[model samples]
Target: MIDAIRDYWNHRIHDLEMTDQPVGTKRFFEDLDEYRFDKLHYLPRLVDFSGFRGQRLLEVGCGIGTDLVRFAKGGARVTGVDLSQTAIDLARKNFELNGVNAEELVAGNGEALPYADASFDVVYGHGVIQYTADAPRLIQELHRVLKPGGTGLFMVYNRVSWLNALSKVMQVALEHEDAPVLTKYSIGEFRQLLAPFAETSIVPERFPVKSRLHKGWKGVAFNTMFVGTFNALPRAWVRPLGWHLMAMCRK
Candidate 1:
């Protein structure tokens, strides 16, 4: 089943890349941002790792290597791994297009990574864990590859959020809800899951208004109200309202 899904996405990526598209265009951000807010949220957290001039960084599930290129441009010795061959090919092409030097691109599984213990200074998995069959095991693998006290940045779907709940309902209504709720995570639950390996911190963020599929002031009003209400309360109080969740863990 997993291999079949991998093949499906691989084909999708190949079709997407054949069109020769840019990364941050309106189409790219609009399509991906509905569920992924990492690009907006990463820069703030990455400020701490700004001086990674000679550091080694590993990215798991690096689709098309968009973020890999950014890490390379920032001077990190970078490697990207993905299950999709098409994504790997696009990543290599993107690396050349962006003029960023990357060490390697490996096609493999995230649950059982192919790197040695304590091999990398930083390990990143953004918007990737939700799709894995065993997220905790993947986290453990990430922990295994990091040097002691090294950092890891991960993004997962927020289970205890209004937007996610709505998405679930929508899927059910559309008769497209066969897949398990693989993308959802709550802060407390995630912390407990990562407790054995690293100290974890959760940051809740709002998907930007610009990326909404609905146009005009009505769309803006709805998203703004939702985010404002959700962010106004503490997680204990509003854990059931936000759209997505991000967790940053240190190994």
Candidate 2:
């Protein structure tokens, strides 16, 4: 199962379809960065990309090192690991193109990471826990690698989210839905997975945004009708319907 997941990602880097820029070039990385932040507009508001200055950080499943580069530029000593060597290779080029240095970047499995216990000040695994073969094992490895009182930032799809329902209703598949492993968790289920943490807070985020991928009438309706109506509703009323569950955990 792990090998299958690795093989799948080895061919498909996240959001690779969004760009025509030459792969491994500066513009290619820039395009990906723009697309990511635009879609995940809540990311910077929630996670302090520049707040980890002078700290050691590890990003597991850091695809092409997009977020990792931001952490490095903000003065965090960053190391990245991915099961896909293709991503690691491109990540090296990404850091080089951006003129930022990373502590290291290697191709490795997240469930059994290659680092000492308590080795990092921050461990980040966004959009990765769900795709791994063993989510609990990967979570435990992330916890094991963090120093006492260190932070762990993670994200997984919300099983009981508006997007899930919309996908079913509209008969559209979520990105990577056909992967070897893709699990979604409810709020309570996600909290249970973070049991090793001393303290944790989960925020349901990734609300409706205008689509750049979906097309035809479905896209038009979602962009014209759904986005406005959803955002117009009182946030408190629709809070739990968010598509992504963002968790901030302390060891």
Candidate 3:
């Protein structure tokens, strides 16, 4: 099962790379600050990476190495591992393009990572854990690789959120086959999963405009309803009701 998924990802990334173009100069500048803002907003909420500076950092499932680039540029000696060879290639290319030097970028599975135990000061995976067949084993591997007091950061789809339930209805009842399946979790479930190796905290946060409305009145209505309901909530409440969940655990 893992091999099949890895193959699928490799093929998919290869295809994406063939047609890939850098985010245009204008759009890049506009979006650049937003990513930094997001990092700032979420970093404090997550674990502190500042203390881990000069220590080894490992990123799992680093698709095209976007965050990997950020980490390397931030000054930690970094290595990025992915199951997709195409992704590794693109990540290496991205490192060269961005003038950031990663310690290494290699192809490897999350289920069985290729590294020594207690090898990293921080293990980071953004939007990658939900796709795994076994979330526990994957987290265990992450734990095994972290040194004492090291931290791991993960971002996953929130199942309890309103947006997720709505997406399920639209996908099943409305026959939206193109919609992605997001594995959602309650705060308790998330904490339980990571309890083996570290103290855990789950921070729920919403990402506005995850996708655009499709076409007609139906799409517009759905979009408006979601925006109206969520937009008025206080930022403090937003995390618990948000579409995405982020967890930080210290080993």
Candidate with best TM-score? 2
**By the TM-score metric, which is better: model 2 or model 3?**
2
Query: Per-residue lDDT tens digits of candidate 2, residues 158-206?
Result: 9999999999999999999999999999999999999999999999999
How many steric overlaps does candidate 1 have?
1
Prediction-by-prediction clash tally: 1, 0, 2
lDDT of 1 at 179: 37
What order do you get sorting by TM-score, best first?
Answer: 2, 3, 1
- What's the TM-score of every candidate structure? 0.76, 0.99, 0.80
- Candidate 3: which pairs clash? 159-184, 204-239
Please give, for residues 45-94, the per-residue lDDT of candidate 3 as tens digits.
45454445677999998877767776776778899988878778877877
Question: Could you give me the TM-score of model 3 versus the true structure?
Answer: 0.80
Regions of candidate 3 where Cα sits further than 4 Å from its true position: 13-52, 172-182, 213-215, 236-238
Tell me the tens digit of each residue's lDDT in model 1 across 144-213: 9899988788776676766666555544221112333255667788677777555777776544333334
lDDT of 3 at 68: 74
TM-score of 2: 0.99
